[model samples]
Target: MKTKFNYLIILLACLFFMACNQESKQLKQSQLPQNIDWEYQMAYQRGIEAVNWSIPAVSMICMRDANFGLGGSYNTVYWLSAPPTASIEALTANNQTPYASIFLNTKEGPVVLDIPPASDRTAIFGSAVDIWQEPVADIGPAGEDKGKGGKYVFLPPEYGGKEIEGCINVHVNSYQVFVALRCIPLGGASYKEAAEYSKNINAYSATKISNPPEGEYIDMAGKHLPTLPKYDDSYFKYIKELIDTEPLQERDMVMGGMLASIGIVKDKPFQPSEKVKKALKKAITDGYDYLEYMFETPGFSFIKQWDDRQWMAIREPSNDGFVFDEGDYLLIDDRGSLFHWATFFPRYLGKATAYLNAMKDADGNFLKGEKQYKLTVPAEVPARDFWSVIVYSKKTKAWIYSDTGRVGLSSYDKENMKLNDDGSVDIYFSKTAPEGMESNWIPTNGEDFFLLFRFYGPQESYFDKSFELPDVQILK
Candidate 1:
């Protein structure tokens, strides 16, 4: 009878153990999504920066109270000089030559764009950028005009135009549009003259009044050109500000909902709870990992001619749309990935200096301005207009400021680069100019920098990989 009692007690213990196991599993299942929220937030954070990258570069103009607009507190038109410095407002990674720029708030009406005639060497282009910084229309060289400049009337979305129809008509995808003009002084035009002609690029209310006020120019020389906002916790603030000011498109509604779940909503205040912020911090880690992989993938890079070369280019467009049937088939992931990695302006192969920035030397090591290096351009370079090698700060993403006040050696510099016996050119980057190769030498000022190899009006050879540029070979 005692033995029978012992067996009953053992069975009861087994039952209790099984029940506890089941209860633990149920709890884990209930908490799974909450625990995985970190992964969700990372993807969410990247999307915010990728989509609204250009806002800070433009909005800072207003935030600075630049006193720019005609007869008002803000001046929409800002003129930048050739070879943009760190100080130029709204700076980009590959900002070469003089620039005439404006931010259009067409909530009022369509803004008319007027362009001066293009000289042979003056590579003037006006790009109409939406709030997303996507190119709505690129007017000027390599545009519909083929450098024969004309007046372009920019119409806002859902517009029934009430303005004159004599000029070329282009449409803006969003109401909050920013236009930037790049003019490289060519055919012997004076720098001052080129700067003044850029001012001719103007925008004013198209329908509000006949002959809307002419655009006033503010010299952007030596002024701090704002770069796009950083990708971080503060990135959310820029996203909120943009959504608040600009009209949101229908496709973005889904993302807007996701954002609101994290306390980011248009017209509503953003108030993220501590739990959300904690999840987001971890999400940021995962987000950067995802972005880092994109740089390695071939889809994001088009220059895949040589397997061993680290120099790759974002040579093609990632067709992005949220909905597949309506043709946003490629969508946000890859598009956002590229935008975060580089400062991009939408255009074709040969418009503004097409660039390939190298963070690594030829040996696949990080490029250090502390070390001396040599890059050999073998005989023939594939370019229609010109090609050059420029040094830039790896940290600032701006042109590295040097004692010479010169940034890079251009084929058009008239300084005359020394070519090899086989017609190849060797460009050197060092803290000081090499013995006799002063023109070919780009100073790093002992500062760690990267190289931006630009082929303005790139030729077929660049696409075909026939004219291969040698890697940055370490000299010392």
Candidate 2:
């Protein structure tokens, strides 16, 4: 009997071993591939994801480099002499006001931005942001100082320095910071006057506070500052520099790991393998087109400003002003699409401005530059300050240059524009002026274009939907 029991136990043991061996074989079979082809595919996917994830950072770096190309460096201010023309190759740059750009590096220590007090003639309108384009402080009247203009000191992530008195201290997680302030001409201020007022803004290291050097302001107007990110392997290079320079966010640790997989490790020199580069080359182009598609076909009603009108709001509802940090999951598509077409987002969208984008006309067709259209600006626009309609090339998101050098129409141009009996204005848009409508026409340069309707100091009516702007109508 004992011998029979022993034999049965041995048989059971043999069956268990066989089952374990079979499971092990299946697991090994299901293991991921490690061949060159597999590596290429994985890298390509990672690259695409990386591009979408890092669009803001890449754009910031491109702006930094663009400023560098224009002989503007860290702690230097680059203010436009006039409203930007096609010469300013930035995405959706406003032609309504002159711009001021400053790049600050806090790697050494804290940096200071001395914002001049807002005057009735002109006020600075912009915010300071980290490399991730997260706002550290808003510069002008709508910002932290409430237009009382003072020194905005930006400190590094691990900054242990004592807070300086009489300074608005902003703690930044990244070392590289950028400030894009608009010198808005107001109360009959000329564009050049506004540009000159921006010169009062100063930037220097906090260590030099006792004897701050004279702030250098460069007039970058009419210069080609190519601030657009290229859709190529160079995209990787831009993001690589960003990754190396800035501290990784805690929320992006997993993404950081993924980037490391594709030879974008922080503090490590990036020399991608030939296969990886080939993968990234294709991935970058595809990724860029994907963002363009996302912009055109948003596929969500949340992007729409008014259900009746085709015009879309440039910003989506977010606790973090479209930075996508508050949500449990990242809003990748929204962030990617926004920064793809525009730059310099604010920390919190203030009622001071409202921007509505129009790509399609009333019938839901894309606006063709060759076609003629008219936008009826109502007599009572919900803009306490002013309103403007700027036209930009769909291909580049930059100004469309034509013989007239007219890229937009604003309330300030009311005297020149043709007005109707009800006090509303009719603005024409076509490749050429519609005969008598030259003064009211915005030339599209025969390219597919989009419209940005900006409301400076947007009134409560604009927010409550009581005053809805009419859609662009095709003029036969």
Candidate 3:
């Protein structure tokens, strides 16, 4: 009886080993796609994911190389002399407000962002985004400093220490973070006043005992600063730099592994053959089309305040603004769509701002200057401060320069706008404003235009998803 029992145990062990061998074979087969076409397709998709994930890093590289680059220095804030102009720069609905940008380096230690005060009308909103375009922290009124002044110390993900007192300690996802602040001219303060105040913001290593050097102010008023990346071979170099610099998150690691097949591995020099370059070029073009479709078409964005409203916040969970969903599963396509079509500004703020150029108006046609439209802002506007509408040329991605020197109309216009009955205000848009409605007019310059509606200090209505913005109605 003992010999028969031993035989049965041996047979079972042999069967188990056979099954394990078969499973291992199957796993290898699945991991190595069937054909060359399948392999190319997989690698191509991985390349797109890599580019989209690190676009912000490329922007920083561009700043470092271009005139807009603040002497190619990190841990320094560059306060633009004035708002962005058409000569250089491209983005959605950048208004005529003073802005400051800082590239913080936390590899050595935690970086500190010294913030200034934000009053009722004149407030500054600073948003910090990690190298992966993830929101690290926010400053100013809508953020930790809360309109008062204090130090915001941004710690890296690998930080090894207890919380430091007297600072807003932010554990970020990546070592390099970009903090862009917009100074809103509150009350009746002039643009120059808000701009000069933006100079007060500073960034330095928290390890420093002595005062960090004061931020250098660059007069970007009439200068040509190129902050967008060039779509060529050099772009991949920036991508490699981003990979080597920041510790990859889990999702980033998965993509990074795949990128090795295409020669983008860390410590491994990128030497793409002519064929590889051709493949990558086509892949990037397709990737851009996919990203544009993410915004122009429908997939990742969700209606924020109102069901029918065109104002859409990104579809990522409201709690975590920049991180994409699917956690471990990692919807790479979702991440690519998110940052490709959107930005990281105002990422962690209480106030909600929407990029409105995608598709507005009841008709859903591209906004053209040839047509006349009206945006009916309801009573109160549901803002703690105020709201404004600015026009941007789709071609330049900058404020449309006009002889009138007017790019937008704020609720804080020198003279209050004429409101209709029931306290609603009607802001108009066209190549030419109606004689009586000039105060509410935003000139389109007879070119394709985009619009951004900013709800500064948004109230409960916006958070509760109760407030709604009316469609841009085109009048005959």
Using TM-score as the measure, which candidate wins?
2
Error of 3 at 325 (Å): 5.8
Q: What would you estimate as the lDDT of candidate 2?
A: 0.86
Error of 2 at 6 (Å): 17
Cα lDDT of model 3 by residue, 1-476, tens digit? 99999999999999999999999999999998465775566657776766766665566556545643536467666776665555545455355577777777778888888887886556887688776566767777777778897888888787888766978889987777777788878787888888888777877778762567666666667766666566666777888787777777775676677677778877778888766676777777766766666655555643443556565554654456655545656555566665543456555445635333335677777788788888887877777766777777754455676666678777777256788888788888888887899888888878877677777667787667677678788895
Model 3 lDDT-worst window of ten: 349-358
The residue-by-residue lDDT of candidate 1 on 154-190, one tens digit each, is 6778878565567777776667666666676778876
**Residue 57 C-alpha lDDT in model 2:** 87
In candidate 2, residue 341 scores what lDDT? 82
Candidates in order: C-alpha RMSD to true structure: 5.3, 3.4, 7.4
What's the distance in Å from true for residue 73, model 3? 1.5
| Cα lDDT computed for each candidate against the true fold | 0.63, 0.86, 0.69
| lDDT of model 3, residue 407 | 82
TM-score of 3: 0.80
